[model samples]
Target chain A: MRALVARGLPVDFTWCEGEARARALSEATGAVGRRLDLTDRAALQGFLRAVVDEGAPDVVLHCAAVSQARGLQDLTDDDWDRAVEVNGRSAFALCRALGPAMGARGGGDIVLVGALDRGQTLPLPVHFAATQGMLSAMTMALGKALGPVGVRVNMVALGPLGEGLSRALPASLVEDYRAFSALRRLGTAEEVARVLAWLALENTFMTGRVVTANGGI
Target chain B: MTGRLEGTRCLVTGGSRGLGRELCLAFAREGARVAFTFRRREADAEDTTLRLRALGCEPQCFQGDVADGAHAQAVVGALTRAWGGLDVLVNNAGVQHVVPLALLEEPDWDLMLNTCLKGPYLFSRAALRGMIRARKGTILNVGVFSSERIVEAPAHYAAAKAGLRGLTDALAREVGRHGVRVNMLSPGLLDVGLGRMLMPHRVEEYRAQAALGRTGTAEEVARMAVFLVSDENTFMTGARVTPDGGL
Candidate 1:
C-alpha cells in the first residue's frame, strides 16, 4: 500500500482483521482502509458492491492470503476449506463481483498475489500449496475470460519475504530460505508491490500470466 | 558513498558490446570488481575496459567462446583464482537467428542450442563450484522473451531459449541448497545488440506490440540485471524476470 501510494497511485486497502494497523497505514499514506471479513461471502459481496458503487477502481488487487502450515497427518478438512476460502475462493468471489462491472465499463485490471508453491526448494504446507495452485489456474482462466473486454488478470508469485517471516521463524531459517533465490536474499514488500503496480498500470499485453518476484526463486 | 555492490566480484559473458557492455559498466559503476569475456572482439573488450578504468575501477577482459564447455570452465577457473572466489555470473553471450523453422539449417540449430542454452549451463555449472564452496553467489542467464511466450524467432533460437528456462530452473533447484541461486533475464526486443544490426524491422514491430509502445534501452535492461544480482534481490531463484516495458 505504501509502495503503491509512493508511485502516486491512489490506493484503497483492506485487512481481514487488523483494523488498527490498516487504519494507521491508510492515515499515514492517504489511502482509504476498510476492515472487512473477506472469508464471509455476504461481507465480501457487500464490500465489492460498496467499492463498485463508490466508482469502479481501475485496478483491484487481491493480496490477502491465509496459510496453515500443518503436517498432512495433523491437517483437517476444515483447515483445508479455510485455506481455499481465504486464498483461492475469496479471490474468485472478488473477481466475479468486479469483472462484470469492469467489463461493462470496457476495461480494468485484476492482480492476485500468489506464492512460489512447489519448485522453489522451500517447504510448503499441503493446504497452502493447493490453494496457490488453484489461484494460478484461476488467474489464467480469468485472463482468457476477460481479455476481449480489455480486462487483464495476472498473478505475481512471490518467493519468501525473509524479513517479514523472521518475526515468526528463526532468522537462520529465514536466511536459509533467502539462499534459495538467485539474489541470495529475501524480497521486500515494496519490491513486490512495485511489480504489482506495474502489472496493473504498465503492462498492457500481459494477461493470464504469473510473474515471479522471488529474486529468481 | 559506497556503491551497492562494493567489493563484489562480478563477471559477464560477451561483454564487449551491446547489452553485455552496459552490464559490465553497470556492475563496475556499482563498485564491483568487474571482468568479462568477449569471444573475438578484442578492440571492443579493450574499449570497455578503458571506460571502466575511467569510472575509477579496473575491469578485466577475457577472450573465449562460452559455448565451449572447456572454455567456460577455464574462464571461471581463472576468474575464481584471481578474485579468490566468484560472486556473480551473468551469462550474456547469445546469438539470435531470424530464419523460419522450415529454413533453419542443422548448423544454425547447433549454434543456437550451443550458445544460448548450453553456454549458460556450462558457465553456471563451472561458477557454482566456487560459489557452493563459498556458500554464496548469484547467476543471471541472458534469455529472450520468446522463451516464455511464442515470438517470431527461428525454431532453433526459440527452442534454445526455452531450453535455457529449463536449465535455469534445474540449476536453481540443484545449487540452491548450497546457497547459490540461478535465474534468467528475458528481455523483449531492444534497440541495441543484434536487434539494431540484424532486426531493425522486428524492433519496430515489437515497439508497436509493447504496452509502452517503445523498445527498451540497453541500460534500462542492465539496471534490472544489476538488481537481480545485487543484495537487494534476495528471494528470487529459478525465476525468469523480463524488463521489456510490457510486450
Candidate 2:
C-alpha cells in the first residue's frame, strides 16, 4: 500500500488477517483495509465483487501468503490446506476475478509476490515451497490466457528480507540466508515493494516471467 | 548381463493405466519386483498384473486413494514387508480438468491439488522413512512440461504439477545426504492418456512446435523413467529431466 501510494497511485483496498492491523494500514496508507480470511470462499468472492464494483483497479498486487516452518513428518493435512488456500488458491481467485475485467478495459497488470525460497534448497516447510511453485506456474498460465485481452501477469520473487517472514525465521537460518546471498546482507521490504511496483506499473512486453530480487542468491 | 533394475523393489502409484501402467511394465521388464496402486480400476489393474506376470515378474497391486495418508502408509508398509525394503517409488497418478479459470470451481481445484501435489507429498513422506533408514532410494515424480511453457493449460493443472516440482527439489536437497535420489520427469504432449484428449489441431500445433517434429510416446518416456530410478542414475539428484522431444 505504501509503495503504490508513494508512486502517486491511489490505494483502493488492502486486507489482512487481523482487524486492528487492517485498520492501522488503512490509517497509514489511506486505503480501505478489511480483515479477510482467505480460506473462506464466500468472503473472498464477496470482496472481489466489491472491488470490481468500485471500478476494476489498474493493478492487482497479491502479496498475501501464510507459511510455517514444519518438518515433513510434523506437517498435518490442516497445515497443507491452510498454506495452499491462503498462498496458492487465493492468488488464483484474485486473478480469475480481476483479470478479464482489466483486459476488457484495454490493459492492466497483475503482479504476484512470491519468495525466492521456492526455487532454493531452504529448510522451509514443503507446503511453503509448493504453494510458491503453484503461484509461479499460475502466473505463467494466466499470462498466456489473459495476454490476448491485454492483461500482463508476472511474479516478483523476493529473497530473504529484513522484514516479514524472514524475521520469524531462526537467527541461525537468517544468518545462513544472509551468507548465501551475493550481497552478503538481507534486503529491505521497500526494495521488494519497489520491484513489485515496477512490474505492476511500468513493465511492458514482459509477461509470464519471474523476476528474482534475491540479492543474487 | 543383469537387467538395470535387477532385484530392485519398486512401487508405482496409479499404475493401472496410462503412463503409470507403461512405467510398471518397463520396471518389470528391467527385473524389478513391482508393486503398484490403483483406485477403482480392477480391470486395468488385472491387465497390468497379467502383463507383468507374462514378463516373469510378480506384481502387487493395492487399491486406494493416493491422497490418503493412511493408505499411503499402508501401501508402503506392505511393500516393505513383502520385499524387505522399497528401492524406488514413482508418483505417477494424476487427473486433469480443462475448464477455464472462470468456470473452475473449488472442487476441481482441490481434486487436482490433492492428486497431483499432496498425493506425492504423502507418499514421499511415507516412503522417505524407509529410504532414509536404508540410506538408499530413488523417487521419480511425474510432472507436466506444459507448466513450464506458455501453452494453453488450466491454471489448476499447472499449479499442481509445478508444486510437485517444488516438492521434488526440496525433498531431494533434504535427503540427498542420506543416499536417496529424487528427480522429476516432465513429459510433453504425449499420445497417451490425457494427451489423447487434445483436439487434433492442437496436437498438430504441439507437434509442429517440437524440435523433433513430433510429440513423444509414453513408452519412450518410460525408458527415461527407468534410467532415472536405476543404478545408471548415480550422481544425479534435485534435477528435472524433460523427455518432451525438445519441446
Fnat for every candidate: 0.26, 0.00
User: Whole-model lDDT, candidate 2?
Assistant: 0.80
Task: Compose the digit string of candidate 2's lDDT tens values, residues B7-33.
Answer: 999999999988999999998888999
lDDT of 1 by residue, A48-137 (tens): 899888877788899888775467898899989888998998999888888877877878889899885344555567787888889988
Q: What is the TM-score of each candidate against the true structure?
A: 0.71, 0.55
Residue pairs that clash (backbone atoms under 3 angstroms), model 2: none
Docking class of 2: incorrect
Winner by TM-score: 1
Task: State the local distance difference test value for candidate 1.
Answer: 0.78
Off by over 4 Å in 2: A1-217
Which ten-residue region of model 1 chain A has the weakest summed lDDT? Answer: A162-171
lDDT by residue for model 1 over B4-112, one digit each (tens)?
6888899899899889999988888889999899888789988998999998888778898888888888888888778898899998888756677788788988887
Q: Model 2, range A8-90, lDDT digits (tens) per residue?
A: 77887656656787788788878867767899999999999888887888899888888877779988999999999999999
In terms of DockQ, which candidate is strongest?
A: 1
